[model samples]
Target chain A: DNCRCAQCVNQDTLQRNFDTFAIPKDLSPQEISPKNDGVDVLWSDSHKSHYPWSWLSLTLRDISHKKLANQEKLWGATIASAPPEVRFDDVMSSTSPKGLADLTSKIRQYGLCFVTDSPKTPEATEKLLETIGPIRNTHYGGFYDFIPDLALADTAYTNLALPAHTDTTYFTEPAGLQAFHLLSHTPPANKPADEVLGGQSLLVDGFHAAETLRKESPGDFEILRKVKLPWHASGNQGVAIAPDMAYPVIETNGGNLHRIRWNNDDRGVVPTDIDVDAWYQAARKWDEILKSKESEFWFQLEPGRVLIFDNWRVLHGRSAFEGLRRICGAYISRDDFISRWKMTNFPREDVIASNMQLR
Target chain B: DNCRCAQCVNQDTLQRNFDTFAIPKDLSPQEISPKNDGVDVLWSDSHKSHYPWSWLSLTLRDISHKKLANQEKLWGATIASAPPEVRFDDVMSSTSPKGLADLTSKIRQYGLCFVTDSPKTPEATEKLLETIGPIRNTHYGGFYDFIPDLALADTAYTNLALPAHTDTTYFTEPAGLQAFHLLSHTPPANKPADEVLGGQSLLVDGFHAAETLRKESPGDFEILRKVKLPWHASGNQGVAIAPDMAYPVIETNGGNLHRIRWNNDDRGVVPTDIDVDAWYQAARKWDEILKSKESEFWFQLEPGRVLIFDNWRVLHGRSAFEGLRRICGAYISRDDFISRWKMTNFPREDVIASNMQLR
Candidate 1:
C-alpha cells in the first residue's frame, strides 16, 4: 500500500484524481491534536503525520472550491446600479489595518470605485496614491491636471467626445490603476442647451462584454483573440515621446480574459495580411457591446469626487462639454496595485491552504 | 504477467525508474520497422508500439543534458577575443533558409554579434531590423540617426564618455535588441595625437559578471538580486515624458538570470529604509566587476559595419571623443528576436523528441 500521508500525495496529480473518497478510509487519523503551528495525527496504521496550519487550511479551501481574494467578481449592467463608492474620509483615515482592508476590497470587487469628499487639489490625489504605492509616471507627469488645452498632445486635452476605451494602449505595459478627480466644473455661460447635456463620464465592464461575446459568438471572439493590432502615440509636439505597441484587442491567458486594449484614436494602420473586412465586422460588434446601454454605467463626476478604475479591465470615456472643466489624476502600475493588495489584505490561513493544493 | 507495451509505461515515472532491463524479455520485438513519422515495433506478444521520431529524439537529447537553443552561453574577457560576427552581404542575401539559420546561431551563441560590409546608410539598418520583425519605436523613434545633437533629449546625444550600462532602464519593459550602424566618422581637424584616442566602444557581458559575483561574493549578489532599485528618465525641455521604473539590478526567474539593468545617471534616489552602507558596498563591488579589464571587450566601430546585441544581457559604453560621428540604429523587441530565431532555426526531430520526455 502506498503512503497516504498528506506530504506523500503528489500535489499536481491530486486535482486530476480528485474524489471525495480520495482520502483513503483505511488511513483515517486515529488521534488528532493541534500543535503550535500544525496538527499531529496518529493514523490507523500507527503512522504519525504532522500537517502545518497553512497546508491544512489550503487543502480544505481547495476542497471547498472557494475563489481567491484577488480573482475578480464579474459584473454587468444588471449589477451596475450605483458605482461602487467609499467615503474619502474613510480611505484617508485608513491607516489602521481594518480600514485599509475594506478600501482595498472595494477596489478589488468593482473595477471602478469612487471616493466622495476628497479635497479638490492635485496634491490630494498624489497623497492618495502614496497610501497604496508610488506614482507610475508616463509621458504624462505624475498627478497631472487635465484642462482643455488645444496644444496638448492627447485627444483628452480637448473638449471632444471620446468613445469608451482604455488609456495608453501604446505602452508596452499599459497603466493599471487610473484615478480622476474633478477639481472644478463651470457650466459655460451662453452655452447651447444641447451642449451642456453630454459631459457625463462613461464606463463599461470590458471583461463582462468580452465574456458575453465569447459565449454568444465564438467565431468573432476567436478572430479577435488570434489577431494582433498596432497602437501608436506620437509624442506631443516638443514632448519627447513616440510610443508604439502591438497586441490583441482582447488579451487572454489560458483562455481567461487578461486585459482589453481599445483606443480608436491611437490605433495604427492595420497590417495588410489580416482580413480587413472580417476584422472590421468583429470589431464593430465589440464596439456595439461596449456602447450598449446594457453594458455602460454613466455618472457625472462632481468636484471633490474621485473615480478610480482598473485601466486593464475597464473602458472609460468622457462626453464633449461646452464648459470650463478642470480635472486631476495619476496612473499606477499593476504590480504596485497587487503589492498594495497583498500588503493591506493579508491572505488568511484558509486562502493559503487552498493555494497549497495547487502547488 | 502485466502488459509491458510502450503506451502502458507511465511517461512521467519512466525517468525515475529508467533501466535497460526494465523492458520485459519475453516482449522483445519480432520485427522493428521505421514508418513515415515513427517506428513500429511488432512485439512477440503480437502487440505493436509506435514511437514518434520527435518524442524519441527529445528523450535522447534530454538524457544527454543538452542546453536549449535559447539559453545563453556566458563568457569572460579571456574568451571575449572577437565578438561573433557575420558578413552583411551574407545576412542581406540570406533569403535561403540555411544562411539565416547560421546567422541566428551566431547571435544565440554570443549575446552580441556584428555584420560587416553593410551599406553606410540609415535605411540599411532599418532593412536589417525588418528581417527579424517590426522596429520597436520608442521616444527616440524607429531607426534614429545618432549625431551629437545638443538639442536632443538623451545623454547619448552628447560626446561625453558613457559608463558601461544598459539603455532605457527607466522603461517598464526596456528595448530588447539594439543595433548600431556607423554611417560616417570624421576625426576633428587639428586633433592632438593623444586626443584621437577616445571613442572605442566598450562592452561587458553582464551575465558573466553577475555569475562571477555570485561565485565570489554570494552576499552582495543576493542583495543585488533581492533589492529593488528605482530608475528615472526625465524628458528633454518641453518634451512631454515622465519615465520611472523600479527593479532589481540582476533579474532572474526560477533562479536563472534573465536580464540586467544598470544606469548610474538615471538611477533614482535610494530608498531610506535599506542599509545604506551595505547596499553601497555591494553596488561598488558590482561596478568594479563591470569596469574590470577581465570583463570588458573593446572595439572601434567604423562605417559599413553594424553591431547588434541583446540589450538585456550586454552593457555598452563609449569613450569621450572629439570627432563628428554619425550613427543610425533601431531597437527590436525580445519577442521579435525569439520569433526570428525559431523561424530560422527549427529544432531537429531529436531535440523535439528529447523535450517530450519532460512532458
Candidate 2:
C-alpha cells in the first residue's frame, strides 16, 4: 500500500512523509477508478496511489530489445578522415548552449570530440571545462599543466612512448572523461619542421575493438569479461593506490558492452588461482585487435586545440617525443557531465517523468 | 615472452620500456634454470626473465577458500553496549600512530567506529577527516554543516525521521566513507532534559542483513543481486544526477558480497521488462530484515562524539525530533581511504609484493 498522494509526499523536498513500511502485509486495493490518462487506486488502508497508463503497461514488458546499445556510432581509423569538432568560442557562449550540447552528443555517440581554436593557456582550458562540470581532483591535483618534469611517477609524466590504455586503472571508479589541450609542441631547434617526428597521439575505439573480438572469438570475449584483474600505481611516494575490488577488463551494463580497462603497465601480476593461460590467450587477441592497422587513429595535436574523450569507452596513447612539449587537461567525474548532458538534451518534464516512472 | 628484466623496466617509474607486443608469437623458452627463491628462463628470442616462487604458486591455487570474508566481524543490536571506539586525540596524534591504526582497522572490520571527545565545531570535524584523507567534493560541496534552512532541496534538511538506507544511490560510485559530527542537539526551548526524546540515530549492518536474506530465501537474494535497478536525484535545481549504468541493490566482488545500495526514496521507476512481482517480494523481505530489532542499533548523539562509517556497507537513519540540531560531516572517496588503510595495516614490503606479483 504505497501512496504517492501530495499528502504522503512533500512537493518541496520530494521525500515521502508517510511510512511505507508500516502498511499492513495484507493491504490490497479497495477500489480502482479509471481515468483518461491513468488510474486511481484506493487501498484498504485508506491510502491512494495514481499510476499512469505508461507505468501500468510496463509490468512484464521486455525493454531489452529496445536497449540503447546500437545507438552509439563505433568507429576506427576511418574516423580520422572526418573527426567530430566544434568551435571553442561557440561552446563557451552564454546566449546559446547549442555548441555545448553538440559537443556532449558527439562524445556520447563517437566516444571522442575536438574543440578547435581554444585558448592556449591552462586557466582558459580549466574555465572551458568548468562550463560543463567541476574538475575532478586527484593526488595529482585538479588541473594539470606541465612538461616532462618527472614530478610524478606516472609514465605520462615522462617523454616516453605509451601503449594504448585507459588512465587511472588503479582507481576503483576510473575517471569518466579526460581532456587534453596541447599548449605547444616545440620541435628541436636543430631539426627542421619537416624532420620533426614522433609524438603523434593515438586514439582507438575500444567498443569497436571489443565488438570485433566478440564476433571473431566469443570464447575469448567471455574469458576477458569473466576475469577480474587487479591494477595499481605504487611508484609515487606514500601512494600505494589499489582498488579494494578488482574489475574485469571488460564490463557490461544491461547486456551491452560499456567499459574497457586495458593497461599492460598498470595491470598487476595474475593471481595464481585463476586460469592464467586462458586469460593471457584472450588478452592476446584483444591486444592484436587494438594494435591492428584498421583499429588505430593517429594524429598530431596542434596548439589552441583541445581533445576530449570518454575514458570508459576509448583507449589513448602517445609516441615518444623530443622537445619542449606542454599539455594541460583535467578529469571530469561521470555523474557531473551526464547531469549536464541530460539537462541540455531532454526536456525538464520528460526528465522528471522518466526518473519517477517506476517510483 | 613478457620479460621484466632491469633493462626492460625502469626502476624509478616501474614502467616497462620493452614492447611486450613485439615478441614473436612463436617464441618459446629455450632453457629453464631453477634458482633458490625463483626461476630464470632464456627465451628463443635470446631474452631472459625471472619469476619468483611466490608468483609461480598462484596459478590454479584456489584462494577463494582463503577469502577475507570471514575476517570481518559482523554485529547487531548487541553492538550498542560496547561499540568500537577510539579517542579523538589518539587518531589525530602524530608521535605514535597506533590510534589512527586502530580506528582504520575497526572501520575496516566492523564497518563503523565512534571517535569520542571530538571538537564540537565544523572546522575541527573537517580537520579530523583530513587526517585520514582528502574530503570528497560533490554537488553538495565538501564538509556539510547546516541547519534545516531549506537552503538545498533534500529531505535531510528536515527534522523528519529517515528509513535505514545508504546515501547517494544516484552516483555512479557512491561515497566510500561518511562521517557525522553532531555539534549540538538543542531540544525545543520548553522541553526538559528527560523529555528530550526522538532524536536517536539508527545503524543497520547491511552485509549482515543481506546474508540473513541469502540464507532465508535464496531465490529472492538472486533476484535482488541480478536485477539492475535505476536511481535518481532530480529534486535539486539544475541537477538531475543519474548514473549511466544501473546497479543492483546488492553487489559482489570475487564471489563475496561487498556493497549494498538501498535507498527506496531515491530508487527510480523499475523497468517494465523484468519480473516486477518477484522484485517487490524480495524487496519486502529486505525491508522486514532491515527494520527488525536485531538488525538495528539505536544511539543518541553527543556533541563531542563523532561517528564514522563505511557508506558502502552500512545503512544509516535518524528519528524525527522537535529541536534545533546541527550536524557536520564529509564524504571520503574509496581510493583515498583504502590506500591509507592498506598502508597502515600491511607492511610496505608485503604491499609491494602484492601489487607487483601479477605484473
Candidate 3:
C-alpha cells in the first residue's frame, strides 16, 4: 500500500503516548482479579464514534485530537518502554516475593495475558512486541505491512465487529500470542470499547466450538477434510497474497481446545464441491455463536494497556465503534511467548488465554 | 483475456480450426509415438525466429511480416497435428498414424503435447489454451494485457515461487495442468538487446534433483523438513498465497525418483542449523542438470502442433532473453489429463514436448 503511515513520523510520538495509558512501572504478568466472579473490562470515551452504524461516529472523528492529547499525557515520550509481560486475571497477583514465579507457571498452562497501562499508538505497538521478545513477521500473501493499510485503517477495519476468531489457523503453525495496545477508546472514556456499543472480545474455548461441530456436523466437516479449495488473488494493487494452503477451517487435538480459524472474506469457494448449502449452514451456526454479545467480555483497552490473546484458543474481536479508532498490535509465536514467560519464572495456567475463557 | 478472436465471431471457422488441432482426429494415442500424449499443445513455424535472443532484445520493435512470409515457405503450412495424451519419446515419424497415437499417450501421462507450422502470435496463443480445455482466468498481474492496460499481463500479485511449484498451489486443492503455447520462439532470429542476455526454456527434474540430494546431503535435506522460511511480495497488486503446508525441495517416496521443487528466487535463506552453503552447492549442481541440454529436449513449438508437460513433475524455464517474447498459456489439472489418458491407455514415461526441426 502506498499509504503515508508506512513512514509516518508521528509513529514515535504515538507509541510514547500509549505507554502512559494504565500499566504499572515494573512489568510482570499479574492476575488483576482472580478471585472475582467475573472479569471486568471498560472502554474509553473516544472509542464509540468510528462505526458506520454509530450515532457517536461524528463525535469520535471530531475529537481525534483530544484523544491523542490524553494519550500523550499518559504515555512517556518513548514507545519502546513497553514492559515484557503481563497477567490478565488474579492468577499472579500474589504480594509475595514468589509472585513472578507463580506467574510463570500460569503462562505455561495458558497461552495469553493482559498487561495494563500500555500506550495505544502504532509506535507503541511496535515497542510492545520488541520489549516482549522477537516478533514473527507476517507474510500477508507476498509482501507484509506491519501496520494496517490505509484503506483498511480508514474504515476502522479494526473496529469492524470481528467474530470470535484466531489470526492464522490456516498457517502450519499460527503466530502464537497477539498483543493489542489500546491508545484511545471511543466511549465511557475509561471503559472497555465493547461497553460503548454491543461489542465484546469473544473467546470461544475453541475446544467448545470444535467439540460441538464434531458432534453436530461431522458429515459436513468431512467435506472440508477431503476438499482443497483454490484461493488466489491476481496482483491486486501491487500486493500478491499467495494462494491459500489446504488447511481446514477447524483443526483439533487431544488437548482441551481445538484451533478454529475462519475468515469468511478470505475463504475461497471450493470449486469442485456439489451443493455446499448444507455445509455453509452448519458453519454459519458456529459463526453465530462467536458474534453474539453474550459470549464476549467487554473492556476498554485504555492507553498504557495491552491485551495479549492466544491465536489458537482465545478468539478475540472488537465491537462497533465511532471515531478514529486505533489499537496497535504485535504477534509472537506461542513457543516464544512461553519461553519468555518461563525464563522470567512466571509460569501458571491463569496467564493462559484458554485457562479461564472456556468451560 | 477478453481480447476478440475469430472463435467469438465464427464458430464454424473456430470449429474447423479446432478440428484440425483436435486430438485423435488424425491418429490414436497408441498409434502415436510414445502414445498417450496430447490435449493442450501446439507448435508452429510462424512463431519461429532466426534469432531468439535477438527477439528478446527487440521488445520495442516489430518484425517485418515479409520476413515471416519467407520463413513460412521453408516450414510448410500446417506442418503436423497431434491428438490428446501426447508424449515426447514416442513420435517417430510425422506422417505415421502411430506417431499421433504415441504422442497422445505421452500427453495422457504428461499433461501437454506439441505440433509444428502453427501461428505464434498473441491471438493464436490465447486461442490455443482456450481450445485445449478450460481457461483459468488470472486477473492482471504484469502477464496479460488487460482492458485499458497494455504491455503488461498481470494477475494476483502472489509472489514467492511455490515448491511443488504448481499453478494455484496455495489453493487448499490445486488448480489443474497448465499449458504454455509458445507463440514466438525468436531464437534462430536475433539475440536480446539487454546488458544481461539468456532466455532459454529450462526444465529441472525435481525427482532427479531430490534423489541426488538425499543420497549426498541428507542432513541438509532433513533440515529443510523442519525449518519454515518466510516469503512474500507486494507492490501495486495483492495476492495472498498463504498455505499451511510446505514440502522439502526434494521428496522421496516409493520410487527412487526424487521430486524436485526449486524456486531459487522465492525461497527464504536457509536456517543456521542447516548447512545452507553446502546445500546450495548441491542444489546448484541440480540446477546445472536442469539447464543441461541432455536433460532438456528442445524444439521450437509451432503452429497446428502443440506441447504440454506435467506442471508437477516437470519444472520449466527459459533462457532469459531481450525483446518481446510471447507465449499464451492455460492450465488443466492432472485429473483432467488422467481422465483422458484412461480413456485410451497409459503409455511410457508419459507425454512431453513438440514438433520437428533441423536436428
Candidate 4:
C-alpha cells in the first residue's frame, strides 16, 4: 500500500518497508479523515497513511515540469554586457548559503557565471569547488592545473585556438559544471604583462542557438535531434573512450531542450547509412549559428576571476594565446551538482509538509 | 573536409586540424584515382585525400547498427542450467588476452558471467575489476567490502532481503558493470558450515523481461517507455542524489532495447498529473514478470567465485541470510568499461584498413 505510517515507512531513510507489489489491486481507503493541514486514511488492508494537503497538491502537478522554460533565460552576445558576477569572499563566508545560491541560480539562468577576487592557487580553487559538490575525477585527474605542456594528446593540452564547443561529447553523461581559474598569464621575459596577446574565453548559450535554429528551420532542428552522432576520444594511450550509446547533437525531454552534445573535434566519421547529406547541411547551419557574431560572447579571463559554466547548456572555448599562461579547473558531475541545487532550492511548502507528515 | 591525409590530420591523435566550418559549400572532388585496395581523391579546394575500400564500405552501412540485436542473447531462468562462466586463473595468467576477451564477450552477450577460482580477498577482487576498467567512485567511495552493520542509511546496509532491481537509478548514467565477490559466508558461531541458510544471489535478465512484456502487452510496454519517473537516494547524511532528467523504465534507441532503469526501492512519489491508474497497472504487470519464477536465476555465492553483471541490463538481488556474510565489489563506469570492450573487440578489417590508409 506504500503507507506513510511510522510502522510502514522509515522516517530516517524515507524508504518504504512494505512490499510494493504485495498490495492488492483495487485496494481503496476504508476511512478518510481530513484535518486542518492533512488527511488520515485507513486502507482496506488496515494500513494507515497521513498525507499533508500540500503534498497531495504537489502530487497533482509536478512543480519542476518544463524545467528550462521556467529557469533558463536564453541570451546571446548581449549577455556579455552584464555578465553574472559574484564575490568569492561572500560566497565562502556567508552564514546562510545566500551567496552560493545566487551563484548556482546564475548558472541555471545564464549558463555561466564568474566569481571574482578568488584565490589564484589550484588548492584554493579546488576547495572553492568542493563547496558546491565533489570534483568528478576523469583520466585527467581531479582539479587540473596545467600550463599547455603538451603532456596529453588532446588539443586542450596545447596553446592552440579552440572553436566554440561543449566539452566531453564522448562521455555517456558529460560533465555538468566546469570551473576554470586562470591563476596567471605572464608575458615573455623581455616583454611586459600587457604584451601577452589573445587567449580570450568564449561562451555561447547553446540553448539560445538551438532555439534560433528551431525557429529558423524546424527540419534542421529535427535532424539535429534525431540523428545520433558517434563521438570518441582515442588520443590518450590505451584509452579509446566512446559512449556505448551515441547521442544526437541536441537531446530533448518532453519537447524541451535538455542537453547539447556538440564537439566537431571529437566527432567520429559520419556514417552514410542515413541521410548523411541532410545531417551535414543541418550541422553546418547549427555550426554557423554557434559561431555567429551575435551568438559569441568573448571575455578576457583574469587571475582572480573564476568562471563556472554548465557544460551541458553552454559552449566554451579559448582563443590562441602567447606567453606562459597557467590555468586550473575541474568538472563537477551532473548528478552531484544537480543534487546540491535541488537541496538548496527545495520548495518551502514541500519541506514543511514532509517534516510535519513524517513526524 | 575531414580528410585523413598526413598533412591534414594528426596521425597519433587522429584529430582533424583544419577548420570544418571553413570548407566551401560548392566543393567537390576534382579527381578520383582507384588503387587495388584504396582510392585517392583530389578535391576542388586542392585537398588530397585517400580512403580505403573497407573504410568506404563501413561508412555506407553502419557495421555497428542494431548493436543489441547483434550482440545480446536473451534468456530467462533456463540460463541457470548453463550459466556463462570463465576461470580466474585463465583470465589473469594468460599471456594473450583470449581469456579476457571471452569474459567480456560473455558480459556483452549474456549480461553477466562468473569468474571461478578467484582469490578470496577484496584487494584481489579490486585487481580483477581493474583489468576491465577503472573503479567508479561514489558517495560510498570505491571497492566496498562490508558486513550488515547499518553503517549507512540505505537498506543495502541491513540484512533484509532486496528485491530484484538495478542499482543507482538516481545516477545520471547508471554504472555500466557491477562486480560482487563473496569473501565469506560463515555460519553463526555454533552452526555447521552447511547450515548457512538463504543468501542465494538472484539475477534476472531485464532486457528479456521487457521484451516479453512488449510481446504480451504492447500498451503496457509503451507506458513503461514513455512515462518518465523520478528516482532519488537521500538516505545518507549531507547527500541527496537525483538525476536532472528523470527517465522511463524502458529506454529504446532506434527501436531496439537499449537500457532498463528499474528499482522500486528508489522511485519517488508518482506525479498525479499523469495517468496514475494506468501507470500502476502497467508497472504491476512489469513487477509480476520480474518476480515470476520463469524470469529468475538464483545461486548461492561462495568464495573463489566472482560475479560480474551489466547494471544497465541485468537486475540483481540477494535473499535474506543469517551468519557472518561478507561481500566485496565495485562499479565500473559505463564509458570506461565500454571503451575497454570496444578496444578489445575492435573490428579486424577496420584496423588493417586504417593502418594502410593512414600510412
Candidate 5:
C-alpha cells in the first residue's frame, strides 16, 4: 500500500514531475545540534583544542546532472529511486519466498532497495541481518539513530554536519552494502507546522564517479600512490574505528573503484605530499558531481520500510528535516548478496521488465 | 686531525665514558612542559586540549662498539667510535696540494671523512648544500636554526629528545646523502654548567640492520606493507610530513639494504589487518636483533666535522644531554652522488665502502 511506483502512483503522472534532480554537494548529517546549526561529538574535545580555525574552510559543492532520469540511455542518473513494484517469491508461507529473492534482485540491479512492513528497532535490524547473512560493521560514527539527540549539545557527544563521502576508503578491503531504518526523528527546528516536511535520503554512485575520474585524468588518479590522508572516529571511548595507519581515500584496482573512510567528521588532516594533492583534488571534483541536485533522489522511508544498498557503488546521506528521525544499519559482503540472488535464478531482469511496462 | 679511527682510539686507549643505549618508552619531551604534551603544531587548537601527554615516548640508550674490538669479525663495530673529519675547499689553501687528493680518496674509500681547521659556522654547512648542486627538502617541514626560540618549542623547534630512527623514511623518493652541522647549541638546561658535558650523536648503518633483517627473518621484513604506521611532523605551515610510507624501516632492494625512518616516535599506530599484525610481529622480531648491543656503531660529532653518510643505509639519532643542541643539515640526492662518483673515476668500492663487512 505504501509503494507509489508507476502502477501505484501512476508513473506517467509523476513522470511529468520526474525531471531528474542534480546531486547534492553537502550531506545533512543526522543533526549536530537539536537546533540544526552544528554538532559537538566526543572527538570534538581533541578537535576543538588542537586544530586551528584556518582549517574550517570547508568546500562541498554539487555537480549533479539534470539532462535525464538515470534510466535514460547514456544520460540516465540512477535507477535507485523507490522501486516500481514489490517483488515476491510467494511459494512458502513461512517467508516471502519471493520477498528474499526479490530484495536480492533489486539490490543487484539498482544497487539499492527499500523494505516496508518491518520493525524499526536495532534489534529488528540485527534480526533482519540474520535473515540476510553476515553484516560487516562499517558505520563511521554509530548505528545512527538519525533522529535528533537533544541531550548532548556541542559538547562532543552532540552530532555535527558531515561532508558527502564513501565509507572505509582507507581500508585494504572495505565493508560492502549498508542498510538503514529510521526509528525516530524530531521534525526540523524552523519548519512551519503545516509545511509538507520530509527527510529525503540521498545516494550517489561512486562506481560511476571513479570511471569519470579515470576518463578525465589518469595521471591525476595515479597521485594516490604518494598520498596518505588522515581519518579518525575516536570521539567516544566505546567505539574508535578508523584504519590503523595513514591510507589513501580513493583507490583503483583493475578498473574497479575501492574507497576507504570518507566521512568528514572522521577525517584528521590531509597529507602534505604535493604528488598526493592532485588526487585529493580529483576526489573532490568527483564528489562535486555527486553533490549536484539533479543527480540525487529520495523516497520517504517511513517505518516498516528498510532500504538495503550496495555500499561500494552507492553513497548515502540524509536530508534536513523535522520530526524525530532514527535509522539503524547493518552490512553484508557482496559475495553473499550475489549468491542470494543467484540462488533465485536472478530475477532482477524480471522485476525491471514488469516495472518497465508500468512506466 | 679531527678523525680518530682505529689507530686513534683503540680499546686500551678508548674513552669508555660513552656507550650505546636504547630509548625508553615513558620519557617526556625534554623541551615541552608536561601541560602541553600533545600540543603539536599541526593539530587544530580544539583537538590538543584533550591529550595531556605528548604523543611521543622517548629513550636514550648509549651506542658505542668498543666492546666488540677483540672480535675481528666485528671490525665493522670497531670503527663505530672513529672521529669524523671535515675539509673546506677555501680553508685548504694553506695546506699542500697533496692534501686535497688524499682526503678525497679517503672519503671515496671510507664513505666518510673528517675535515679540520676549516671554516666552522652554520653558513659553512649551508654552502656545502649549494656546492652539492641542489638541496631537496625531503620533508616540507622548514629548516630551523638549531637554536630555535623556546616559544617555538610548541612548534617542534626546541631541545627535544628524538627517537632512534633514520631520516626520509616517510619519503617515497628520498634525498640521497645528508650533512647536519652543529650550527648553534648552548649548554644543557638546569645543568647550565654541564652545557659542554654532553650532547653526543649516534649513527648506525641502515645497511647493517637491513641485511640482518633480510638474513634472519624475511617474512617479518615483508610485514611493513600491512603496517603503514602512522606518522606526522607538521611544524611548518600547511605541511604534514609522514616519514614512513612505502619504504620499510628495514628493506632490501637491488641486493642492497635500504632504510628510511627509524624512530618509533614518528611511526604512529600499526595497521589492523591480520597481515599487518603478522608483519608487525616480524619487524619486532628482527628489531630484537637490530637492538642487540653487537650490531650497532655509535659516535658523536665535533664542530667542522661534516658527517656524510648514505641516507638510504644509515639510521641516526642523538644522545640528549646538557644545554640546547643545534645542528644544520644539507641533503644531496643519491643520484647526484652516484653520478659525481662515477664521473670522477671515484672507485665505487672506495668513496664510502659499507661498514657492513661479512661478520
Candidate 6:
C-alpha cells in the first residue's frame, strides 16, 4: 500500500477511497504549524499528518519563487577592452578545477580570449581545446591546418585583405567557438615591401558595436534585428553543397543578444520587397560602427599562440599578407561550450529547473 | 537617371524628379494589353511603355497568381511502406543530372532511402556521399568507423537494444542526414546454439506517428508540441564534450512539420510545476504510438549497403544483438541537404522570393 502521509496520498484518490470524514472532506489542514524540520497538520478527520520540510521545499520551490535572474553586462565601443589572456600551458596542465572554471568564466564574460606559448602543433591545440570541450568538426576537418592555397574553395584560404565578418554565416547553425593557432609565419619568398607589413589579425566586438548602435540609432538597430538577409556560399567546384541561409543580421532571444551574422562577401541577392535604400543606409551605419577603431582589437598573431573566441559575438578578419603562414584551428559547437560552463559552475538541478521554467 | 518603369523606379524619388503630370502622377495603366511577348502599358501621362512579358510576368506574378503549392504526403502505419531505393553505383557513376535529382527528390518526399550495391568500403560510402554533398564532420569526425569495443564511451558502440530515437538530439542543431554503412558482421564467440539472431536496424516515421496522434488524441499531441523537454548527454566518461538542449518533442514552422526530437534515454529531469501524472500519461501514449508495428520498419542492413535518412523525420534504432558488428557512418548538416535539393530542383529566385513573402 502507498504511504498514507498527506503529501504522499493523492487527495482525489483518497476522497474516493474513504468516507468523507475518515480522510477529511477537505484535506486542507484545519491547523498547520511548523515543528522540528516538519509541519504538523491537524485535519477535520481528527487525524494528523507530519510532512518533512525537505520534501515540501522541493515540491513548492518552483511555484512559490520566481526564476533566478542574471542581467547580461552589455559593452559599447568606448567600454571595449582587450580580452583577458591565460598562459596556454596553464590551461593545458592545470589540474585544479578552479583554473578551468576561471577560464570558462572569462570566456562567458568577455566572449574572447588568448592563450600564449602553446606548442606549435595541431594536436597540442586540439588537446587544449579538449580541456574546455570537444572540437566541433565542420566541413573543414577537426583541428584543420590552414595555408595559402590557390585552389582553395573558400576566401579564408587566400592571402587577401579580408573584411570584418563572422565565419560560416551561411550555415544555419554556425560554429560556436573558433580556435586559431599560428603554427608558423615566414616572410614570403618574393614579397612586396608594402605587403610584408600587412596580414595582421583583426577582432571586433560585434556585441559592443550592436549595443552602441541600439542606443545611438534605434531605427537602424531595429531594421538589422528584424530584416532577414540572404547569405550564400557556392559549393566547391565539382562539389554539390552550395548552402544558402537567411537570418536577421542581429538576433535576440528573451531580450538578450543571441547572435550577429555579417559577411559582406558572402551576401546573396537582397529581397526585392524591402526598401533597398533604407536597408543600405542601415547596413552602412552598422558597418561603420563595426570597423571603427573604438570597437576593434588589432594584433599580429605570432607562432606558438592561439586565439579562441565566441563566433556568435565576435567578428574576425585579417589584413592582406604576403608571407608563408601556417595556421591550425578547430570549431566548437555552442552547446558543448555552454555545457562545460554549466558543469564547471552551476548546479545541475538548478540549471535544469531554471531552463524548464524559462521555456 | 533611373529607369522610369513603374516597377523599376523608386516612387519617393521619382516624385521629386518630375512635375506631377510630366512623369504621370499615377502610373496606373489606362489600357493594359498583351502584344507579342510584351505588355503595352498606356499611362495617364499619354506615355506608352512596352514591357516584355517576361519582365512583367516576374514582377506581376505575385499579384496575378498564387504560388505553386505542393502538399507534403504524410503516411501512417498502414500507408507506410519501405522507402524507395536506388543503386549506389547508379548514383556514383551516372553522368546524367537526373540521377542525383531523383535521389534528392526521393529523400525530400520520403524521409529515408537506401542505396543498394554499395562497395563494402568506407571510402566508397564517402565518395557516394560526396556525389550528393560534402560530408558534415561532427565530434565523431568526418567519417567514423564503429566496432564493438568494451571500452566504448557511447552506448551506440555496444551491442545493446536502442530505443527508437533521433541522433544528437542534445545538440542545439542536431545533425540533418545520418548515413550508415554496415561493413561487416560476425557471430559472437560465445553464442548459444539456440540464439542465432538479433541486430536488425529499426526505423519509425516520427512524423507519421505524430500526425496520427494529432488526429486520435489532440490533447496529448498538443502537450507534446507545446512542452519543451530538456535533453542531455553526459560527457563520454573521460571525454569533455557533453551537450544539453531543450526543444519541444514536435516542432513546426508556418504549420509545416520542421523537426522531431525524442530520446527517452537522453531525457533530463522533468520540471516540478507540470502535472507529473498527466505528462507521464501523454509521454506513454506517444511512446506506444512510436513503437507500434504500424509506424515501424524493421530490416537487416547487410554489408555492402548504405542507409541515409533525415534525422528530423525518421527515428532510428536497433535490436539487441549477440555478435561482432562493424559499421561506418557520418552526419550531414540539414542546410547542405536542403541546398542540394534546391539546386537540383527549385529555382533559387523563386525560393528566395517565396521565403521573403512568407516572413
Candidate 3 segments exceeding 4 Å error: A1-111, A117-127, A139-150, A153-159, A168-174, A186-200, A215-217, A220-236, A253-258, A292-294, A338-359, B1-207, B211-359
Q: What proportion of the true contacts does each candidate reproduce?
A: 0.02, 0.40, 0.00, 0.34, 0.00, 0.13
CAPRI class of candidate 1: incorrect
Docking level for model 4? acceptable
Superposition error at B208 for model 4 (Å):
2.2
Q: Write the per-residue lDDT of candidate 4 for residues B69-99, one digit (tens) a residue.
A: 2368998999988999999987786487767
- Lowest summed lDDT window (length 10), candidate 3 chain A: A68-77
**Ten contiguous residues minimizing lDDT sum, candidate 3 chain B:** B350-359
* Model 5 bad stretches (over 4 Å): A1-98, A117-125, A135-146, A150-162, A168-174, A184-193, A224-226, A238-240, A333-359, B1-359
Candidate 2 stretches greater than 4 Å from native: A1-4, A13-16, A53-70, A186-198, A271-275, A355-359, B1-4, B57-70, B186-198, B270-275, B355-359
Task: Please write out the lDDT profile of model 6 over residues B244-322, one tens digit for every residue.
Answer: 3347789876465778988765554456557755666677788888888888788888888699988988899999987
Which has the greatest DockQ? 2
lDDT score at residue A358, model 3, on the 0-100 scale: 13
Per-residue alpha-carbon lDDT of candidate 2 for residues B295-327, written as tens digits (9 for 90 to 100): 999999888999999999999999998878899
lDDT by residue for model 6 (A248-350), tens: 8899764668898987655544556788666766777888898788877777887787888889988999998777778888888787777666556655544
Candidate 4 local distance difference test against the native: 0.80
* Per-residue alpha-carbon lDDT of candidate 3 for residues B162-262, written as tens digits (9 for 90 to 100): 22233432222233445555554333335544333334444444444444445766765564433443221111121222122334555443233323344
Model 1's interface RMSD: 23.7
Ranking by DockQ: 2, 4, 6, 1, 3, 5
Model 5 chain B scores worst on lDDT over the 10 consecutive residues at B58-67
lDDT score of residue A69 within candidate 1: 45
- Residue B49 shift from truth in candidate 6, angstroms: 20
Better model by lDDT, 3 or 6?
A: 6
Provide the DockQ value for model 3: 0.02
At residue B22, give the lDDT of candidate 5. Answer: 18
- Predictions: Cα RMSD each: 21.2, 3.3, 25.5, 4.0, 30.4, 9.3
Q: Would you estimate the TM-scores of all the predictions?
A: 0.48, 0.90, 0.36, 0.90, 0.38, 0.75
Candidate 1, B1-359: lDDT as tens digits: 11223554323222111222234445567998988987888888676777666555544344412534456778777654666888877777845656555566677667788888888888887887666655765445556887788566566877878778898776667777888887876777777544664688988899999999999999999989987765544433211111323477898754878789887655543444578567766787888899888998888898887888888889999998787888888877664565456446654332222222211
Better of 2 and 6 by lDDT: 2
